[model samples]
Target: MDGQLLTYLFVGISFALYIGIAIWSRAGSTKEFYVAGGGVGPIANGMATAADWMSAASFISMAGIISFMGYDGSVFLMGWTGGYVLLALLLAPYLRKFGKFTVPDFIGDRYYSNTARSVAVFCALIISFTYVAGQMRGVGVVFSRFLEVEIDTGVYIGMIIVLFYAVLGGMKGITYTQVAQYCVLIFAFMVPAIFISIQMTGNPIPMFGMGDTMASNPEVNLLDRLDGLNAELGFDKYTEGSKSMIDVIAITLALMVGTAGLPHVIVRFFTVKRVKDARKSAGYALLFIAILYVTAPAVAVFSRVNLIETVSETDYKEMPAWFTNWEDLGLIGWTDKNADGKIQYLGDGPAMEGDGNKPAFDGVSKGVNGERVIVNPSNSVNELYVDQDIMVMANPEIADLPNWVIALVAAGCLAAALSTAAGLLLVISSSVSHDLIKKMIKPDISEKGELIAARLAAVGAVVIAGYFGINPPGFVAAVVALAFGLAAASFFPAIVLGIFHKRMNKEGAIAGMVVGMGLMLFYMLKFKFHLFGGGTSEDWWFGVSPEGFGAVAMFFNFLVSLVISRFTPAPPLEVQEIVENIRIPSGAGEATH
Candidate 1:
């Protein structure tokens, strides 16, 4: 079959499978909807958590970011994976022991104040919605490019598929579906990577291929050759850091903490049956996630090398089929400079152009006329601006893989995006129905009424999230970073203090969330919106970019909560005993009072 036909077959079959699972495992009560009835095994919960954590950003965007940023992108890998270590060691087990339906419930009851719970609800909604917007946009982008549909039409297709499973089956349905998604996405990601690795280094394993000798010329290491190509093209070495040390450290730390704080991820721990399961699930989740995480850097390296080698010697007019193919889809583009039919791949490097022969743009080229245009006046090196997200999707094509493989990858991308969208929407829905409405607004509401409210809330969130996807606020990776920052600044501190420190009163939790979330929002808007004028790295307060500003805000939250908690009265004696009970794994057997 042709690639397009195969793509439809794969995607169609996957959708059918998901819908079937939803019907088979549909939730029967609010308990199942909220916590999957707290019977999930460690392995199952681990897979679900991996699917929940690896959103559109991780699946589609992380490799692309690493491809371009090179060594600087290691921060994302380290921060994200390292955060799981924190979650496993410090937060997941305790939260599971708390035996709450939602994160806000834990905060509200532990702190003994509805105000703290409300603040947490606000934080969860803001973070979940912002993150969901990116997932929806990714679904649209993948659909548009691979399925040949308009972006809005693609989004609607995604929304329908997600709504079918997420609304009908709730957490139980979403969990099992996510486990399947993790398999599809991981296979799709690794197949192309393995092919490229074998082609370039005669090694089947991409991770090892990254450091292996080149197949074409065994005298040089693959990485060394890549470094030479990059230097020749006026780029930095592949494994060396170009960003400042402090920025790198701060960004890495912020991302790590942010991952721990993400409410969608944290709540997954509650689905497992026991506190021990939560801990074991974290380890399992990391293991499943690491399959892709470790391979991603290898993919980045191999893809970058493949891209440069393919385009380095070719004239612009004779660019490969993959280049034109992606360009047609708006994922890649080029323009002829000086009316020459041939593409000038050389930049302002000494090897490509004569010394001091910088290339000049005429200010009218599609991909070549930006203030930071990749091309230089020297015309010595190729100045290309390929979108990072295209790297993984285009990897199979670049390595001359079979058509079926390409089509399968297209389906995998959709699976990854939709699986994550379902998880985030679940958080958004449960927070509103379980935390805000049932717990706070109408404590006497019946279970049936809460279920109805939850479904309605899910539908409402889908509509709003779909709108944001149609009109994306920012790039996929950047928008996800903003979500992480918000979660880190607002929720992580409150949860940590609430569980670990007996003296952390409701006042402290509320004040911390309000201040932390408020400050992070202000910083994000200031830089993202240019509220104070054109934003620049030089203009950052205390050398913190908006991406890393979450750490600073989180620190502020921790400090403020500590100071306030010391002066404020401690929790009531009953609450103190409640904390003690939460610390024990056996205590989780009882339902919440």
Candidate 2:
């Protein structure tokens, strides 16, 4: 079968499996909808957690960004992986012991205030929506290429698919569905890495293959060759770091704390039966997540090497079919600067005209050299524009990998995108139905009414998510990192203080979250989106980039909370005791209230 047909087959089968699991495990009660009745086995929940954690950002964009940013990309790997460990070791068990349906549920009861719950719900909504937008964008990118649909149309399809499984099955359906998605995504991610690894380095294991000598030239190792290629093209060495040390540390710390504070990943532990089981699942999830995280650097090296070897100075008319195929999608472009028919991929010159690096094509028209006619063609010597987002998806085609391998990648990308989308959608819906409505607005609402409300909230969330997907703020990983930064600033301090500090009161928590979240938002909008009287890197406070500002904001949150709490009355005796009990290791399973 051809690649397109195979892509359809693989994607179709995976979608069917996800929808089937949703039908099989559809939640029948508010308990099931919220926490899958809190009875999931550790192993199953671990796989589900892994699937939920590894979104499109991990599977599609992480390596893509690494391929371009080189050593600077290590921050993402370190921050995200370290953050998971922080979540697992420092947060999961206590939260599970507390036995709330959501993060807002825990905050509301633990702090003994509906206002605290409302603040948490607001934070959760912001974090989840920002994060889900990346997943939806990933979906659109994959569908636009494999299924040959417009990117917007692809997002529409994704919204429909996510809406069905998420609204129908809720947490119960999402859990089992994620288990399957984990398997598919991991297999899909590793297969291409292995194939390209052996083809390029004569080693089957990608991690080791990345360090092995190139098959064509035994004298040079892969990384050395990659560094040489990068130098030849006026780019930074792949092995060296370009970002400042402070920015690197800030980004890494922000991502780490952000992962711990993420409401969606935190909620996964609540699905399991016991506090011990939550700890067990976190271990299992770490193991599962490691498979992809470890392979990502190798994949980045392989894809980056293959891209430079294949595209640089290549003739536009004689370009391979994959080049034209991607060019047709307007993701890959070439301009005939100096009237040369050959392509130029030098790093010194801008490949695009405006601030945007992406090409704005001229409606299927072709240049004289058979390159896609881009309206925003630059005057720079470089004539190529390849979006970094395409590196992972286009890697298989660039390496001339087999049809089955390519098809499997398409399926894996979908699995990664949809699994996390479902998880975030659940977080958004649960916040509205359980936290805002049932817990606050109508404490006496029926279970059925809450379920309906959750579904309706999901529908609204999906529509909003689709809009952002169609108009993404940045590339997948960049947007996701910012979301992590938001979580770090807003939720991390509150959750940590709520669990560890007996004197932490609602007034302090609320004030801290508001100020920290507000600060992070202001920085993000001004630096990232250029909204709040936008400023350049020179204007950044303390030399911190927007992506790393979360750490600074988080510090302010801790500071504000500490200062405010010192002046405010301490928590009630019952709330203090609840905090005391949450930290105790004995009878943790029975501590679920």
- What TM-score would each prediction reach against the true structure? 0.93, 0.98
Off by over 4 Å in 1: 345-383, 585-587, 590-593
Whole-model alpha-carbon lDDT for candidate 2: 0.91
Cα lDDT of model 1 by residue, 1-593, tens digit = 88889988988998999999999999989888877888899998899899888888888888877877789889889988998898888888888777775778888889988888888899999999989988998898888887889889999999999998999899999999999998888888888888888889999999999999999999999989988988887777878997888778778888888998988898788787767778889999999999999999998898888888887646665565777666655455444454445554544434222111223334344543322222343343344446667788888888788988898888788888898899999999999999989988999999999999999999998998899889877657778888988988999999898887888898888888899999999998888766756476788878887878889999999988888888889889888887777776673562242
| lDDT score of residue 315 within candidate 1 | 67
- Structure candidate 2, residue pairs in collision: none
Error at 21, model 2, angstroms:
0.8
Off by over 4 Å in 2: 350-359, 589-593
The residue-level lDDT of candidate 1 at 61 comes to 82
- Leading candidate by TM-score: 2
Which tens-of-lDDT digit does each residue in 180-278 have in candidate 2?
999999999999999999999999999999999999999999999999999999888999998899999999999999999999999999898788899
